[model samples]
Target chain A: MSFKTTVITILIYFYAACGATAQEPTNYSAKNGLPTNHVYDVQEDKDGVMWFATNRGLVKFDGKNFKAFTIKEGLPNNDVWELYLDGKKRLWVFSKSRYQSYVLNDSIYNFATSDGKTISPAPIYEVDNALWLRAGYYKFDGAEFKVQNDYATFYHGGSQQVFQKHGLNAEAAAVSYDFIFNQYFLIKDGELWFLNADGTVLKK
Target chain B: MSRRDSQSAYRFGNLFILINDKGIIVINTIAHTLKHIAFKDLNIFIQPFDTNQKCVFVNNTYQISVPNYLLIFNAGFELIEKHPFPEALEIHHAFKDSRGHIWACSFKKGIFLYTAAQLRTLYYLKGKK
Candidate 1:
């Protein structure tokens, strides 16, 4: 081969080697021990064990194997929608139809209010080192859920006006509050803006 | 626009990720810095793996149903890896485990495992061949 041809061949081989590093994703389905093919959410626990919420059940993946938990194993329903791991290391599972459950010691049980009613899935907020569900005014005392009628008081007042005062169309902006950090995040006109609870812009 | 089509914000540590019609905007509250990525002709959604977890899963789709690509970001709000998937696989959310393996949960096709080695390879594969 000519000298130029040999150099070109060597460069092509190097380029191919670099492009070959990104392999196709490995699939895991019912054929591979997954409970079902419809997965809704994925979460990892403190121990690094991966958990999946699926249409059929809640699946536990320990990197190499898959284990599923369904109604027979104490899940509220077969269709799980979301998963949340609280500060106490408990796994909270939200199922279809708003039924919520938590898994402790590898066992699933219903999450109910003080009156024995099932708690609907809502954004879990941590306050004062305790977990509270913004919807239905429920608070988890680490043992059971209790009613907290004045939970709305915890939210910062006049937060919407804060956005409007800053010349942002509050109605058009998507705003979310970080209770843990006491800050507000707003997305307006394709730009993200961060502000303090008192309406001072932190970053834009 | 429907509620699902509207913009949404999720917090991972001090980083705030906002998903809008244009793309994603990430802001670091402590550093007072911001980064934005515009994904043309794609709808974006984000779901953090856990409350304390510092990683965010970004699912990019076409027409809001067809899976197009997946982007994972670390605690510092930097794009760690990006991978394209089959359109048939509608991934809802993803999580990166402690071992650096990415677990992508799909709507009907099941979960996909992408190892750290495979993710690192994609870094070199960027740009036209």
Candidate 2:
């Protein structure tokens, strides 16, 4: 073989080797013990049990086996849209069309929302002993979900209005209390902002 | 007549909504009775997101033609927005990510990521050749 052709062949082999070494994500589906292939959300609880919210039901993967919970198994709705692991270590399951709240303890427990209305499947955050739920910030004290004081400010209404206290224009993505800075950190629209105790934005 | 090959299903209030080759099917989970609505002109072939928070409707008027437009329905099943698909992409399914981004899949092509804030198709993939 010519030296030029040999060099070209070696380059092709190198490229193929690199492509073969690239890792591809392992795809899981109904065939692989998943309840349904249309998994919307996934979460891992404190106990290391992986939960998957699928179109058919809620599936739990304990690294070895897959357990599915459906309407036949006492779920009010078959379609599980979202899953959340809250501060209390409770697995909160939200459905697409149902008003009942399904929580996972030793098993799934069904309960009604505070207003007997369906909660929108959105992001849920725990902050200051309360929950930043889709509709608004609320405190669920076992029996009922109570709306917090700063509901109007904390709740996003799709408007780009600056909050009165924080002077932030966007809605908060997540909030965390920083012990190092002795302040509260608010992550909103990918930007991090520090807040004072009075909720005013602290320029930093 | 019953439509076969269901793409997706969701719950709206007390009704279990299913999207098949037909437009939309509403079934009462408790009564196990199908509620028929006078759904006209909407040949909904897909139910992109599992969450009833939003609905994306695609119409394929021609049997062999690709859909040109997409209808977005809010949680209430009201028409919220209508988007035209890019020139020749055939979308099969779509879903919302945890970050609230809408992603659509194509049978021949790969996937497309759409951002609501930008009101445009942010990314597209034609899949590996």
Clashing residue pairs for model 1: none
User: Which tens-of-lDDT digit does each residue in B7-120 have in candidate 2?
Assistant: 333333334444433354444433444433223455433323332222321221101111334455544455454444553555433444334334443434433445454342
The parts of candidate 2 lying over 4 Å away from their true place are: A1-22, A97-106, A147-204, B1-129
Candidate number with greatest TM-score: 1
- Candidate 2 scores a chain A TM-score of 0.61
Candidate 2 clashing pairs, residues 3+ apart or interchain? none
Candidate 1: regions farther than 4 A off: A1-22, A96-99, A115-128, A132-138, A146-148, A151-169, A177-204, B1-6, B11-17, B24-68, B121-128
DockQ of 2: 0.02
Chain B in candidate 2 has what TM-score?
A: 0.47
lDDT of 1 by residue, B9-116 (tens): 444445555565456667676776667766552344333322211223323211111134556545444454565655565665566666777777776788888888
Docking class of 2: incorrect
